[model samples]
Target: MQFLQFFLCITVLLLYCNVSRSAFLCELNQANPFKVALTSTVDIAGKGNFTTIQSAVDSIPSGNTKWIRIQIFAGVYREKVTITYDKTCIFLDGAGSRETFIEWDGHERTNTSATFTSYAENLVVKGIGFKNTYNLGPKQNDLVPALAAEILGDKAAFYNCSFFGVQDTLWDVGGRHYFYQCYIQGGADFIFGKGQSFYEQSVLYYSLETYGQGTYIGYITAQGRDSADDPSGFVFKDCVILGKGKAYLGRAWKAFSRVIIANSKLSDIVVPVGWDAWQFVGHEDQLTYAEEDNSGPGADTSKRVPWQKKLSEGVKGNGHVKFKCPTFLKFKVKAMAVTLSDDEVSDNESDKTGLGFVKSIFVPETHSPNFVPSSKPPVSEIVKQAEVTPPRKIRVDL
Candidate 1:
């Protein structure tokens, strides 16, 4: 059956290979420098001559430029767009995430045959808003909307950007990516797809406007596919999670998945168990889920399940500055720990957590034998709650 499926995939690739002027697939690994800007309000701004995004893309050379800067003016764009590989090494700078908005509502499952597109390499998305509203509703929705922005090439970065939606918001369907000082709000698996990505100092908001208690909120990172050699997972650090429903910090979308969270403020919205096993699909025990120094209303660990990790001082380094964790989970825990210290707090401020404002990590001096993985169900049941009737057909818009 696997071989048959592979054959079918190859057949489809060949059939669609010559349908349109294929976007140049330059080696995304190469570093290029190019600069462009979007400062128009025309129907096809950068389309023909510095008017439309499509036009600017159509004019880019068929390779990764050294550096490309596309400065954009503040505006609300109501068009569905795609940036091809030819526009590699492109930098998009808008007024700000809140000031600039690019919105569309099209679901592949609902609008079957809509071929979702992608961006090129070194695509820096700074100060812009990308949103899709397919699943933004008041009930258990079945619509998996098309991505707000899809990055298919490598080394993509988004600084101070906002991705708004209720389902998959930022689809990292390609290479290494990073998001810094960004805001992503949704209810389900907001940040989904396959990529070696890192999200730092970002705010993840869970919306109850769609599915009240039944809604799935909070996902710092969720990994599904196992890429060949690259770090095929997600790392979230120094992030703030806020919502009003029971939501796991994250879960293994597929077996062998990995996710790390540290030094972040957690609201009571986070589930006690924290991580889900996704029904123990294939490699159940191989998934990596861990957390470090975190404080807030949701940082209480006494009632938390044993599977979740506690911050430790043993991993300290550089005179209490460094912690022995990877990427996203690395500095946030320690940073938050230091920042929450009572000694550092002013005498006028009250300790809200009641755990004191000092860095009192839950590190065990000795390995506790009672520490065991709990059997509680994961907090996120968005997919399970969705009774997708009469399975909708996928739309492949090319």
Candidate 2:
């Protein structure tokens, strides 16, 4: 009888352990079971690899060459997230901008203002919403500038994301960055910094009641290129600038500030005098504020400030200006090539849908050796594969 009881107890313990392990694997492999074989991937849900985005980020080994993908499930993560310089090749994949949001309240003066700050190289952030919830005012005087995201990383790309704040919504602080199909909301000098950045097919929203009140006066950019030799500038191409108040295209944050808004749609909210001098005097000639092929009610250049350049005839807008680094151009070429090729395919696949465009940014149909697809796999095959494969090296902070 004693021997029989011992055997039964051992069997029950083994069964319990197996079930627990299977459950853990199922949750970790919720999106893609074979993702473990492709690249280092981590899933962050309420009950997954790690509860918070920061915890998942912290677990990543520094100076990593392989891309580490952090797939965040739908939730409001109220935390100040930062990707340090040592953590390179990190891909942040969120469920969707509307579903996954990372928010915090910080300001420029306090040095803790940015809700999302990245200082890593080759970082990709997609389908997420980054917000700075610092309130700005009371209809009369008080105003504060907070940053939603500060991208100080080289070759960083943000796709299908949303940045929300009152002032300084996006600080393109340094390096070469690209914002594609992203929504940025702000008021005073919202898109600022000394970065060679491009905003393509993105929405720049100027909120009326968000910043300092009374009259609706807002400025979109304040590019801080200190010298003419600096290869830093902002290019807004095929973007939509629409919002509730009057705004200037940009102001001279530095003497040789450079900005170009080309082939974009501007709403009537854009002021006729579309550029400002700010406090800089006698720097008009040195500044490079230009507009080309822009349309809509606000694109009338006749009333624009005389200092702002109207690109004439064959001269392309800022064509000679090159990015400070080489990797940025390479990344841009790769992205454009992928997009163009995908457009040629005629199959009505799920990845070709409107929502699929957003998904494609982070989860490519086929991945490079360094990347992993974040799509669901066949259940039967995945289970078999999981059974044979060794357990993934993931730290679960339960």
Candidate 3:
């Protein structure tokens, strides 16, 4: 018993010394140092690199060029997390959106209250859920801006993630961003910002919790495009909008607010007027809220706002709509498609897409020559309506 206690004490001392020296914890776990150098596991139980996500991030040097993966284990982290602008090329891999959660309940100014704020460019966050619990927390407060996550970086992508809040849920402030298979749950202008973003196969869930009983009114997006050619807008492709309460698709937060819901599913929760001019009331014509190829009970366009720009179904064969593809900074990547399942796609169909095999297509933010324009011309101008091939589901890439 004495020997065992001595050995345990020595082991603890060694771990402390190495950690204080900034040495890799892989020494104790018997893992390869090379792999440990690239991957920093953030386990709150203290079995990995650091006990907190912020510590794991702080370990990385500023202006990092190589990719560093921060493996966040399953846990409920109730802390505010921020990634500064200089800390780039970070890959935040969580256990799963349902398993790993970063939650906080700050009701302060929206600028200082986001649960997760990432200003680092070239960042990829996967399988994580960020929640701002201001309303859900002890206070069950009034309707105000409680941001879950704010992205102010370029080339940031999120996959299989989720955001939870009320009012201003996700502030996509600037730059080019992509959200894939993510869930955004909120009410009011939950998704408001000026970033050029593409939301693919995501779900926008509106919750009328903060509003008084039967007040069920909300606005999903408040895009802030300020000019005729701001090049920044919100595009939802192959997404689903289903939730409680009635809400407008968006309201012009600025002079030329722009938003598009294309090839998506909308529940009856969507208001018939669809969009609101808001502060830009008389200038509704300048608001660029558009919809195309959408299905579901709420997709009727007859009662839609007059300013809603209606798009056309141009591309054939893909279970998708052709977008005005975008160009990202650093990498002039064209929104392209990759293959999903062999049985799902046919060889002839594959050949027609020009890629022997492919799946989804990257949604556009602005313009790329590879994809058809936002709105295609008449049937006679492109192809006869009868000749157009049916659509199929495919995977997309940037």
Candidate 4:
């Protein structure tokens, strides 16, 4: 049966190899960067390796390092799924968000209530929809924590997927992650946590469905970093936030919490006071909730919180400082006189994450010489320079 399926796969690929694409074969010990050499299929029908997603996941050995592809066919699977910690290097492929999904009705226990939870490293999930239907059912108005997905692993990414719930929709617990062109929806604190993540071109739908617990207003994020050295932040670059009721962009969930909404579109659903200090009233100067180059009715910051002042604080660098826009958790050099280097932030041990690479980075040209792209100082070098010229450290709150 395995040989017959392999023959059929080869026949199908040979018939559909494209001009700008190349066909990949499943081979062991091969050197292809896209190393999807083994496949485990999951389908509601009895036409694949496993009939259920959990059984397919159970087949993978612990500490597995190869790129194992689990292709899920078109269906709405009504089961709670979890990729365990030992099952690393998985590529979950689905038909489409509208055509394929996994959901459950787990209502209590925020730590274990997710319909889909991934705790593995080097994982890539695409085209799947995770929904916790507890609040969407008969208890639609319950202000409870129903998480669609909780990501707590390193070097994981999601693309073209959807996460749905009422509150705490995505628990980006910790790690470095990237979400590209995905859709996330919830009522309060929908997208929260301390993960160092880059959300690029994603869509946020804030449904003010069950918001009446704390302050009567909804909060889009509850991100909280531990300290100045904590490498955890949520950077939403070039995204869209749309909804009905008035909501603050985020509130300080911790003392040194950090969130940046940059180059995004905000509808009138956003409140005039953009952010809330929550319990961090005395430590407002410690947290960082910044907005850059946003537009639309809600983007009007005339009535925003005084702490979040306009960038009219003025520029202090060499005219303009530029960093590469987000692209799949990657960074590039801009070739400017004093631009950051194309440093690889993947699998690094430093507490400073990719966004941290830009924190307090710009040193006035008067303090230093003209730095070409290759000669740009590393993030650590700036700290050493601070020891020399303490006044030259221009702190950026990203």
Candidate 5:
């Protein structure tokens, strides 16, 4: 017993020492770094490395650039940009969410000509606004997959970023991605793709379009791909789902399209059924849309779709099932904390700092402020749609 106690004490001491050293090193790095404004005015007012985003991207090492930081000033960059696969560990630090805007407009349903071969991967577009400006002019919906940025590679992470679009806003067309503190907006099937994505502490906005007279159109956020042991699924934890026009949290576009919304807030705007199989493909058997201790007006089980499972009491809800099984199984709210930080840290801080760590530490009574029940109208109510009048051809600000 004494030996065990001694060993444990030594381990703790070593860990503490390692963590302290790491914190010191991180502080040292943060002490001085290049600010885009002070460093250069490639586009703004300073003398930075390059004027355009593409130029900066071209100048970087294509094969493997470690910790390549690009600070984007507060400006609306109106262009379609694609970060190639060779660009790795690219960090885009924005001035602020509203200040920085990367705007474009593309939709899969509307645009049939825009072509892209998906080979880009291993990138991080953080701390900026990705806006879709395609509908602002005479041109409308001509951009297919009009992604402000399309992540088609593996191991991508988008942090503190904003994705704005109508349809197919974010193509999770990659592998093992993590989105933290990001704001994603779309209209119809906006955030749909086959990539395995985990969105934590993010804000999701769905737009409501008119459907005939008195009817309104809604949006679907995700669509998983064809994979038996996908190992990748949509895990939305501590997120806010809000919008107008009877939006359902998801629609299974493909069989085995799985989503797990746990300890998150769902706005009343979400349809009572929570999810729908796109046009009833008959693969509802493989679809897994589930929730645990979720709140809101949209969370009422009485009106859920017949195919959707409410996870009633029994072996399923008994906290014995493993989340890794890929089946429509339930697990105890396995509380894990993934600490999100700006940069990498040493082993000590990696052990101590909760930055970018995924720990399922969910307490039903207490969750993040943005976390809410799907049945209840979210605190941040959806932008109310005003009654539309016949277009009278306005010249300015139509």
Candidate 6:
């Protein structure tokens, strides 16, 4: 009887484990389901399939095999959006960064503060702006950080997108991500996290409001690589660092944090001491902060931290870093430039009103010989639709 009871208990335990695992997988599937083919396209703007970006994202089935394309119209969507882990191969396209924006007002310690957060693999977001309205300045009781976008998935790429906030603007958390021709703005520890990421042809802008503040001194990055064996590092290539006030290139968030800025241009906003120890004085020697072939006034390394390294010639080739898996290349494509012409302008007087008059006055012929303007609204019209507001002040405890 004793032996039989023990056997029954073991069986029940195994069954419970299996059931829990299945339930977790089911939850993931519910968040992201498997689909048949890439025959459907979801449009946002009360026109096509969905009205909101999150609704369109939720509509996608789990373990999606083919690409799920979501086209967002020109407008400001005041909401937080998330792409869960199971939703793979998603292509989120927007009208333009200035034309289409996603905004929220969440600060650090807030449950849902990030304007956009992605935990899905093989995701591509282009031509959109993500912003957090939580400003970090003297008006606040304490320094409260806000994240515009938090990317936490592998093989994720953002092109021509803009991220705006005052602190922790772009959280490069846990991913092999690539950002091309994107603009990221923040004040302190703006580009941070444990991700192995590559930023190419992107702009990193710092805000002047947080300059000279106590602990909020402008620092662009705070990479958190725990050890030398970790394959996570941030590589900035052919990028530009610009904005107001003095700032450091980066600070070691972890002992083995690694960062590289190669073939980039830095404005005078950067401080002479390019890197910081970040309370880890002795451990600063273990960090791998390096720069090569960088130009502009801030590229001078004469006063950089003594522990900072100047990358060797052989290591500058980017041959040692394994960014992402081989299949990740399937999501890469040449960025397209959209141009408008006079011939494509509408003859209707009402359609040719407002900013259209300004566009009509300056029509350039250098665009494409085959380029024919369509009746669709011009890019400037979409940009004009965006409403700009002054930053808001919030109270918080230190």
lDDT of 6 by residue, 1-398 (tens): 00001111111121112122111111112223322133234344577677778988888887764556677888888888999988876777787777788988787563356889998866777678888876743555344677889888766777677888777888898856777667777888889998877787667777746545433458999998775445466878777787667789998888777777877778787899899888778876567777777888999988887777654333334533212221122322222111111222111333321111110001122110111112343222222222121222100000
Candidate 2 regions exceeding 4 Å error are 1-45, 108-110, 136-142, 210-214, 315-398
> Which residue runs of candidate 4 sit more than 4 Å off their true CA positions?
1-34, 137-141, 210-215, 309-398
Per-model TM values vs. the true structure? 0.64, 0.70, 0.73, 0.73, 0.65, 0.69
lDDT of every model, 2 decimals: 0.50, 0.62, 0.66, 0.64, 0.49, 0.61
For model 3 the local lDDT of residue 326 reads 35
Which consecutive 10 residues in model 6 have the weakest lDDT in total? 1-10
Give a tens-digit lDDT track for model 4, residues 112-162: 999988888667777788898888644645668989999998667786678
| lDDT score of residue 141 within candidate 5 | 41
lDDT of 2: 0.62
Residues 86-116, candidate 1: write the lDDT tens digits: 6665656566676666776777652221122
Candidates 1 and 2 compared: the better one by lDDT is 2
- For residues 1-398, write the lDDT of model 3, one tens digit per residue: 00001111111121112122110111111143322237889888889888889888888898666557798999998888999977776778888777888998877898988999998866778788898988753465776788999999866878777888877999999876888767787888999998878887777777766465247678899998776535567888877787767888988888978777877888888889999999877877666677777898889989987767644232423655565333321124354221112112122322222111111123232211111112223212211221232111111111
Worst window of 10 by summed lDDT in candidate 4: 1-10
Q: Look at candidate 3 and tell me the lDDT of residue 354.
A: 18
Where does model 1 exceed 4 Å of error?
1-51, 110-117, 137-142, 212-220, 225-230, 281-283, 302-398
Candidate 5 residue-wise lDDT at 89? 44
Clash pairs of candidate 4? none
Is candidate 4 or 6 superior in TM-score?
Answer: 4
Instruction: Assess the local accuracy of residue 300 in candidate 3 as a C-alpha lDDT between 0 and 100.
Output: 93
- Tell me the lDDT of candidate 1: 0.50
Note the clash tally of each candidate.
Answer: 36, 2, 7, 0, 42, 5
Off by over 4 Å in 3: 1-37, 137-139, 312-320, 324-332, 336-398
Q: Would you list the clashing residue pairs of candidate 2?
A: 106-113, 107-113
In angstroms, give how far residue 13 of model 4 lies from its true place: 47
